[model samples]
Target: MPMPATALQEQLITAVRQNDAAAITRLLAEGADANAPDGRGFTPLVLAAYDDHLEATRALLAGGADPNRPVGGGNTVLMGVAFKGHTGMAQLLLDHGAELNARNGEGSTALMFAVLFGRHEFLDLLLAAGADATLRDNKGQSARDLARQKGNDHALTVLPE
Candidate 1:
């Protein structure tokens, strides 16, 4: 019998972790689910974005993977990429329809993570993308408030007053 589909999907997840773009494409063609979760519960898209695997990410996105898949706690690929500080990957995700305003369980958007992590490139990118910086978190803290608490002067400088 052929390999189980779940098993094939597991291999696809592995291919993503290995940064094997060719294998990712091949596996996708062979009926593997691009959204398969790894042993640790992280999906291929999540792994690709987290590791800044641009080619792998592109392949996955082309294969119809969800750019907005929730990693956990309601956080999405864009949020993770925001913290990773990869503008290209973040832009790719955004172009793929990733929501700039997706919130974590704490109600924080990608813009909030960019501010908390001090990812200035992402800060500018998010601001330009019209992210709702005025949105608040579970503590009722807006991105600007979080910036103030973290002493993120740069974020404050660019965030609308």
Candidate 2:
């Protein structure tokens, strides 16, 4: 049988989903698992970053959230933040040791997503964080290729030459 969700785990997930930084802090202080994955394979930090909750992201990161942990579709917290055009959040995760070149199940990295979505600021942030511009996805498309295909000249310029 599948294991049931522990009360603390459920509470932690709830606090993150609701963007309650205080509740998350209290739970962590009381020994909650900061890296625990919910049903969707997303840790609290992943959800907070995806939801653009900078405070919650900061709290979880401070409490030791695994920035490299992959969630639904094999995307990491950095990927979610970058894809959503949250440059500040992306930079924060990068500074906290997020792998800039991390690839998803389909081999798409955060840089590729940023360019494909026309998030120039995020693309710049990812590049500055040392994401490999030459890295290709499952379809063999690099971030530059995606940017060119989408007519995102600003994103194209952010890529390494």
Candidate 3:
């Protein structure tokens, strides 16, 4: 079972959900745990990334949140960034050492999400960062296979040759 969240962590999560960068900064300064997860396993960083709150995401990262922290369903922060098509947030996570090929519970990598969603902007970034295009999901579908299934020809071109 997940540990109960501290009041400060809850407040920080609220700031993240609201996309309140200023509030996030203040809470971080007050020594709130940037890596603390909400009731559903969403860390402040993951929440900010999922919401496309770039500034709030940055604040959380600066506050020492783990960029590789797993959120809902064992998806990493990079997964949220990729799923949301937030290329800039993806870059931020990459710069902070988020695993390029980290797999979620379904064994889906960030590159797979980029391909599945046709997030071409993130495709190049994930590819260049060494996201293994050949990594297969639980369904035995590689990123290339997923792109092909989705009829995302452009994404297929970005995958490893």
Candidate 4:
């Protein structure tokens, strides 16, 4: 039988997903796992960061959510923030020591996802975090290549030639 979700864990997840920073703080203070992954492998930090919930993200990080934790399909918090175009959250993760060049299961890094998804601001933030422009995905596609393929001119400009 599948393990039942704990009430505290469920409340924590709801709080983060809803951007309820106050409730999140309370849950964390009560010893909830900030890094707990939901059914989709998405941690509270990842969800908040993806939703641009800066306060919630800050709360989770303060509570010890592993900034480098990988979620759905090897997607890190950085990748989620990048895909969602949350530059501030992306920068926050980087400042908290997130791996800028971390690759997902598909070998796509946050930089690649930012470019492919047209998240120019996030691409810029990732670059500033020292993400390698030359890093390639499983298909051997670099961030620059993905930008070009997707015709995201703004993203193309952020990439190193």
- Per candidate, the number of residue pairs that clash is 0, 0, 0, 0
**Per-residue alpha-carbon lDDT of model 1 for 39-126, expressed as tens digits?**
7777899999999999899999999899877877888999988889988898999999999899989999999999999999999998
Residue pairs in steric clash, candidate 4? none
- Local distance difference test values of all predictions, in order: 0.90, 0.85, 0.84, 0.85
Mind giving the per-residue lDDT tens digits that candidate 3 earns over 1-161?
44334767888888888888889888878778898777776778888888888888888887898987777778998888788899988888888889998999999999998898889989988888777887889989898888878999988676766
Task: Summarize candidate 2's per-residue lDDT along 98-141 as a digit string, tens digits.
Answer: 99899999999998888888888788777776779999999999
Q: Candidate 1's error at 71, in angstroms?
A: 1.8
Error in Å for residue 156 of model 3: 2.0
What TM-score, over all chains together, does every model reach?
Answer: 0.95, 0.89, 0.88, 0.90
Candidate 1 residue 155 Cα shift, in angstroms, is 0.3
> Which 10 consecutive residues of model 4 have the lowest summed lDDT?
1-10
Tens digits of lDDT, candidate 4, 1-161: 43244778899999988889899998888778898888877788878887899989888888888999888789898888777788878778888889989999999998888887888777877777678999889988888888888999997777878
In model 1, the runs with Cα more than 4 Å from the true position are none
* By TM-score: ranked, best first: 1, 4, 2, 3
Give me the candidate number with maximum TM-score.
Answer: 1
